[model samples]
Target: MSKSVRLGRGVATAGILGMLVSVAVGAAQADEVVKIGEVAPITGPASYLGKDTENGARLAVEEINQKGLVIGGQNVKLELETEDDAGDPRQATQVAQKLVDDKVAAIVGHMNSGTTLPASKIYSDAGIVQISPSATNPAYTQQGFKTAYRVVATDAQQGPSLADYATRTLKVRKVAIVDDATAYGQGLANEFEKKAKADGIVVLSHDATNDKATDFRAILTRIKGEQPDAIMYGGLDATGGPFAKQAKQLGMQQKILAGDGLCADDLSKLAGDAADDVICSIAGAPLEKKGKGEVFTEHYKARFGGNPVLNSPFAYDAVYVIVEAMKRAGSTAPDKILAAMPATDYQGVLGETQFDSKGDLKHGVISLYKYVGGKQTLLDVVKQ
Candidate 1:
């Protein structure tokens, strides 16, 4: 019971503490890092849309990291691997292979249907989970691949709903249709054409143009001769905006109908004042009223310096869903992520997100929007 005995006890306690600290540091260093791949048109005309989606995913990653997520008893850090698909199917497949080679845990992109559909096969074969934020083609989900999924409604619902709105609500009898000649454009336009015909609406004309064509004057001039009550354009804002602008130049007063691709805030800037005459259908609930709308909007603007496009919320949700699946599976392997996808019921910035058996959202909501006074406004939300 002297000073020597007390000092020996204190030294022993200090040594134990140092060993524990070293062990803790080693565990932290062993934390697993998972990479999530995002393939979108980060360049070219659709770059804005791609950047919007990428921002959503990037924000989600940052928030998750800040929250100090622990999965499978290990601290996890998520990294984003963004690749530009240029809105091309071939480029999408190339990036898909590259992501597989890079051994990403999952993917949250391939923005357009044309790109998403083709690239999906590569992910499927590689056992990588591919969740499209904006691809709306029903065929993308109908491919029977377990690795494929989407956060938005399909053109199957969006096209018919828009057609019904045109015929019953707007009381339009004659309709003209135009597409951008890509899978997404043609598919949505075809669906609208069929539904419009079945709803007793006369289809005055159907035409085709590429997605990059800035000159829609020729097509608008031809449609002007038809004198249609409404014109449905199955393409993205890049092309749809110019089409609307030219339609205005030709003095066509008919209301413009478009699919989710054209449902963006920048449509007003792209189409100028002609955006007021455009009514577009998006494949999800309005962002401002869903899950964490206002907060997400403020955060997204602060992070990306732009308004949310049609698919940003969906992409945000897609990232959360992937991480949730990773938590459930207790691993970041591609096969495990794909296996956990079918059971996803994630509450995200968008809303309750649950996938059906075919990897499609169960309660897919379609909303109609129109630009009024140079601002995009929601008209209706249709659940399908």
Candidate 2:
């Protein structure tokens, strides 16, 4: 009732308001951060592919931040916590655990098939959704984990296409097959051998190699002795590079063919003149589409100071795919986002991308690429 009593009440109310403001500030900061996991090879032999894929995830986050985020009427910025897997399956598992511990809503990476398959299981167990940009092993999606997804075509699709091209287009009757013995290499080699033989092409010699091995002179001698018209190699850019150079020196006339893993900027540089005429097929068309692909390529060239690698567009598409799924779901919750992913049909640098129930992108096409002048060029899109 008195002036002092009224003044005392005012101070108490102001203190209460300040406390509420402090709590609100803490909550606002919490809502402002959204973590996205990115695991890839920042170092090691597979760094080229992993770093390129990492760039896509990074670019998406940057674009999403610049444009502003709108999720459930709350503004948020995507935060990327990138981990280096070193292209090792064991390291991939460790990275997956680290991302789960960090509480990232989604993951992108562990580029190699060997790493992606093993790491995906850990992510699935942790309820984290991961979309691999370049892992093409058919078993990846076949694992029945709804949280796992990929932007690139699987080896099942690419293998038959590569084999058909080798038989029908290249007109090769006798072929030698070599696989790196990893999930991707073995699966692709098996498919190509089966299909090539069915197409009346002889599987003259079949050989296996370890990914870590640098010496292949014995294998090259064996392949040369077979006198095959063509060589179908199932391996990464690292070994493929050396094989190309060695095969050329061995006086082999067989044209070398390989899958997406063999396509890399560093691979061409390693093989030098030996990389010429190596008919390597890539997972996505890096130069076919103009808008997004060109922007990515320009940025990549500026950053890396050379032409963009084959999987660059696919990596870019992987980001677009995940972002579109999140937009459609209106939530970054892993289950909801993965469910909504099947409905996302976005036109990206890799073309129209739509996922099936098995977490595999339907309507996907693998393009045949050729290395000319030490530059990988998209030759044709094998639509099936």
Leading candidate by TM-score? 1
Using lDDT as the measure, the top candidate is: 1
**TM-scores of the models, in the order given:** 0.91, 0.88
lDDT of 1 by residue, 138-221 (tens): 899999999899999999999999999999889999999999998999999999999999999999889999988999888888
Question: What tens digits encode model 2's per-residue C-alpha lDDT throughout 330-365?
Answer: 887777776777687898767678888888877767
Worst lDDT window (10 residues) for model 1?
22-31
Q: Residue pairs in steric clash, candidate 1?
A: none
Off by over 4 Å in 1: 1-30
User: What alpha-carbon RMSD in Å does predicted model 2 have with respect to the real structure?
Assistant: 9.7
